[model samples]
Target: MLAGIGLLAAVTVGLTGCAGSGGSAPAASGGISEAKAKTATSAADFGGMKGLVASANAEGHLNVITLPPTWANYAKIIAGFKKKYPKIAITSANPNGSSADEVAAAKSLKGQSTAPDVFDIGTAVLNQNLGLFAPYKVSNWADIPADFKDPAGKWYYDYTGLMSIGYDSSKVSTPPTSFADLLGPSYKGKVAIKGDPTQANEAASAVYLAALQSGGSADNIQPGIDFFSKLKKAGNFLSVLPTQATVNSGQTPVVLQWSYNNLAFGAAGGSAGNPNWKTVILPGSALGSYYNQAINVDAPHPAAARLWQEYIYTPEVQNLYLAAGAYPATLAAMQKNKTVNEATLKTVGEPPANFVQLTADQATKAGTLLSAKWRAAIAG
Candidate 1:
């Protein structure tokens, strides 16, 4: 849901603070020689990023999917990559697509020049498509949390956030403080969601938060589905893609989405004259999760892919993650290295002391349930 609308919907530019999809098989080792065609898990294994960078420069291109410039400040990330590696050109597709779409591209575009070299995926989708990914460990591997990465180093979390309510404080006299408050009369015809929960990971997380607040747990999300049903029946729910434009125009004044997205949307449109846009991760719904990053098994530009991974996990890139309001995976390492700026951390906020993190299995179950019941809930 961290989107810069239309930056690259058909072709454009684009967390982990939550759970995701995955498996463990350590990066090929134990006498696994570094063949020229082999995927490099680390720059050191590939003779270093300098060599990888040289090879990638020869290839001169990288294809990425589902990245928008505005999402996590990817505009800056992509621009940085291009400037840093002037020879390697980057083109993205399906900017508004989902984690499922990233997996889909890895499968659908195999052997094509346009195939994605890397992926940013959700926990469930990551687990479901582990076979499609190649194991990779960046130079900053030690900086990442053990729990946030694959035991074998196939994939790892980049950043994360919690589900929260974004509202134009000026439009709604009193904003909702919790899930139950969303159902009150003050919010009718005002609340909107990102997309159908069953299909989109962000939407699905919002639904999970609702379920948790409505007497459900990771294993059972029926309460969330039921809550939305009541929301629809009460005429408070609108199935709109909550973008910055929608918020600016006051068409969808209240949105349920990730805190980073909400905060970004509010910041984009809020001014001194109209400074009431706010984000609230209620006491009842502080779910923390993160998205994962991995290389495609059959990436068109393998060397470039490995180099990209190395660059992203670097300290400078990790700070960019914070600049865009994401808690980077290297947070602790950055702090320890005296590279982390405490003031910058404030912008992204701290991970909740009371947070609900879904496991890969729990996410799959919730996704299935949401798929089966979401459309009927809103009759959408």
Candidate 2:
């Protein structure tokens, strides 16, 4: 039987400001001190997180470790979770600089006292560390398509985002329609891409997209390397991927990034206040990947973690992620809800007209091979 631990409440203070407004100082009644009133205001400024406080009280406590330097607007998700489960205390930690850092964290949690209850990992990492996870088939498991989850329930994808090219409309009159176009003379030095596929999702995505373009399966990434080789030869490859702020600031005209990143950037207002930054889906590309969530095998608060899982999979939470430009993992959830804005929806291309979905086994095999071949091809 799962033993319930003593409830301990701790708040993970986010960068976002506190939730409520403060009232004016009360008039002193019978010589009450002004300092007390000032203290009251300060308390109001940083006093209570009712949601987090309540969650900690009711569901024990939760510790969620994730890839750090946080994503844009992730605070909203954390705040939303607290609102729904105020009794579940959440503590977030980031040890290593990149997603690779999570590996060390997972190892530390093994049969030890300091393991995280929840983990947000990349697909590649998920493939490598399935043993670290505790399999709890989520209540909404049936709703998720077979392609997006682990059959034994070790880990499940919460959301999927495609990697694509974002082009500045002002500089490039015609967007490149396919991978071949990226190698053309006109596009030389016009593309900025994040390098180091071994350590970066964006770089891995570039390899995946290239494989599709070159008739390579996700399991076979040689095509991706060959594709990049040509781009490198053309001198069109930019050293680093552009950030949302950089893209919005118009520092780079063309960038390879996740679709959600492009959507979020455009919604926040693009270059020159035009909101015209656009992402195009490359035809025949195996470029989509998922950001997955898993429960640690030694979760300190399993019940609370499960509750968090249920909450995130709900239509409400799924839609919230969608509104923020993430693609919901459940097709039924997406169809039943209408939270993604029209302008944002318009920019998201339909899955390539004749695309094929990769099975878990296939994706793992392909990702591994592709990583190896990409290194060789790029070095050539």
Residue-by-residue lDDT tens digits, candidate 2, 237-294:
7665565556656666777766555544453332322256666666554366677878
Supply the global lDDT for candidate 2. 0.57
**C-alpha positional error of residue 357 in candidate 1 after TM-score superposition, expressed in Å:** 1.2
- lDDT values for all models: 0.73, 0.57
Candidate 1 lDDT over 1-380, as tens digits, reads 22222121112113211111221122223222324425566677656666676667666677778875567767678878877888677777777788888887788878777878888777877887789888878877889989889977889999877787888888999868677888899998988887767666788888888889989998898999999999999889987787767887888999887665766665432241124567776775477668888888887777777888888898888887776666789988998998986666654555556778788889988888887888898984
Q: For every model shown, what is its TM-score relative to the native structure? A: 0.86, 0.71
Worst 10 residues of 1 by lDDT: 16-25
Candidate 2, residue 371: lDDT? 60
lDDT value for model 1: 0.73
